[model samples]
Target: MKEIQHRSDCPIAFSLDYLGDKWVLLILRDLIFTSKSSYGDFLNSNEKIATNILADRLKLLEANGFIKSSVSPEKKNKFIYNLTEKGIDLIPVIVELMIWGSKYDSYDVKDVVKKLGKDKEGTIRQLREKLSARINSDVPSNE
Candidate 1:
């Protein structure tokens, strides 16, 4: 397989290259919670991403192997996209964002925020465990 080049050696910088934009993470947040797919579904998200930007980000995400797209068997013209394990590994980032935003932004995630604040490492460990368990179940044990 061909190697993929990261923008920088720093872990944060490299991660930013993958999910730096606001729209990318917003889209990911939707995917994680709603399992939404297709152009129309994305356009209808709470953040209201523009059609063109969503298209571009989805393409970039696919190229980077964060997601995979397949045709909808139910509809000839529809498409569906699903997260890869690499993408689902972002739960910690989302959880951290939840904590930070809950602090400074005063969002309504108090319950989760309280949980994270109470035990940050424990929260991360549990989140990672859940993600891993989902991966183990969703994907075959030996793939």
Candidate 2:
């Protein structure tokens, strides 16, 4: 991971230091909103991110504790990425961005956003729980 140079102690700046890049957020959006998890899945996103940038961002995300990766059981050469607790905490932020973008930025309203409109807290809670379950399920069992 590249060392972050904090310009100041402001909270937003600190966040930007980690998540300022559009690609970073997009990757997080894919992780949160879609079923995509593998490197090929990300490489094939609608945004058509370049391979090099995707590789760099994935490494940075893992290094910064937003995500973690493990070898794919079916494909030894591939990896499956999952959100850590820190990354799961960003679900609300992604939801707000989706809502704000749909309203002010002219982005299409996704189904989750529609649910959010009806019940913001409930929608976020459900998303968090779903993601937490995914993380828990990924853990290997001793038995």
Which candidate tops TM-score? 2
Q: What is the TM-score of each candidate against the true structure?
A: 0.72, 0.92
- For candidate 1, which ten residues in a row score worst on lDDT? 134-143
TM-score, prediction 2? 0.92
Off by over 4 Å in 1: 1-7, 110-143
Each model's lDDT comes to 0.72, 0.87
lDDT of 2 by residue, 1-143 (tens): 47779999999999999999999999999999899998999999999999999999999999889998877778777788888899999998888888888897566777877888999998889888888887888543212
lDDT of 1 by residue, 110-134 (tens): 6657877889788767756654554
- lDDT for 117 in candidate 2 is 96
RMSD of each: 4.8, 2.7
